[model samples]
Target: MSQVRPGARRVLGATAVESPVIQPRLRTIPEATVARLAVYLRVLAGFADGGRTTVSSGELASAAGVNPAGLRKDLSHLGSCGVRGVGYDVRALRERIARVLGAEQSRACVLVGLGNLGTALADYAGFGSRGFRFTGLFDAAPDRVGQRIGGLPVQPMTELEATVTGTGVSIGVIATPAEVAQQICDRLTAAGVRSILNFAPMTLTAPAGVDVRQVDLSVELQVLAFLGQQRAVPAGEVPA
Candidate 1:
């Protein structure tokens, strides 16, 4: 049985296609552990690309920024066992983790709003290596439409639904402004986009079962500013 949201199913060309859903293990795995597992996958891919075949638990944990015990615990959720001395087979472990994270197959995505940030995101080529492909680019402005970025011509927002439905685009990346972000989000959900990566500065409301992840650049910068301020505190600053 597919765990993917049914709304993500779409008719692409002459065939009805669906995104490769995460395996059943997702339901049993803790969300925090799942996140760490993805980090571990990236670390393993780096090792594999460098021609490494095997990895010790300590080395893998260090590269992934986790302790050995915690790394073992996370993999344990996947029923993956590390050899007593040999640690784990790098290639095998990566495959196991990718299966659970839904990274084994490329997921189609569409981007709305082709301003500076949106244009930059569309032009990034690194998404292909990580199992994501942007199949459609869109903007509400007429001037932006017909302009090409990253090899795909920007289309008008009027074409958003047909494109998403035809491409089986399961995820949407919204980089529009605050005032119109919710409207864009609503349109994406209505088009059968099950997950969204919102770079807009404001929050968005969506129908039930739609997953929305908000990435606010200014707020993140503010958090880092707070941390930097704390680091600059003088000694003997224990006063309340």
Candidate 2:
């Protein structure tokens, strides 16, 4: 008698048996859809907190600041279809969206640089409530080091690698000056951080598999100024 392994065809005398081949398809969700899902989840949470059990597409769309059809289309990605004359179950929808967004798991985050912007982010109370826990804060300045901000003592940048490894931080925030932003990013990536939130004026580049999001307040303000100037200009007037 010949022994048969799982998924391998077994031969007995003149007969052979084969296992069925199963191929799984990977589902790819659009980045824009994922962002809108977060907004929808928040709106759903508010509804649930208000003792609402169900929400119509139009109502949810209005609350989420999107069109009803577009909201329905987004929800379709989750394979959720509302019943006739009834809307989605608020609590269920919220839980589904949260699961898809990985909001159920808390991620450790480390902050580098203790400048004004960094300090403001450290003091923000929304991080904890939104599944982000600050595990470490670092600064290059000797004076800033050893000082406490937002209940966490600021460590020297020299301790960044150790702190990140010890805390299992997956996300790093760079608030350093433009000159040192890339250096800090490299350090963070080398320390095993794959996601970064950058507030520095200069753009920071990361190696493959690392995600970096930059928030430039100056650029945002300049965009607003440009729009203001456009509005100020008359239909036929050309500014020299």
Leading candidate by lDDT: 1
User: Worst ten-residue run, lDDT, model 2?
Assistant: 1-10
TM-score list, all predictions: 0.83, 0.83
Worst 10 residues of 1 by lDDT: 1-10
Clashes of 2: 0
- Report the lDDT of model 1 for residue 231: 84
User: 18-69, model 1: which lDDT tens digit per residue?
Assistant: 3447543333565567667878888998999999999998999999887899
- How far is each candidate from the true structure, as Cα RMSD in Å? 8.2, 12.7
User: How many clashes (backbone N, Cα, C below 3 Å) per candidate?
Assistant: 0, 0
What are the lDDT scores of the predictions, listed in order? 0.83, 0.81
- Angstrom error of the Cα, residue 173, model 1: value is 0.7
- What does the lDDT read for residue 44 in candidate 2? 83
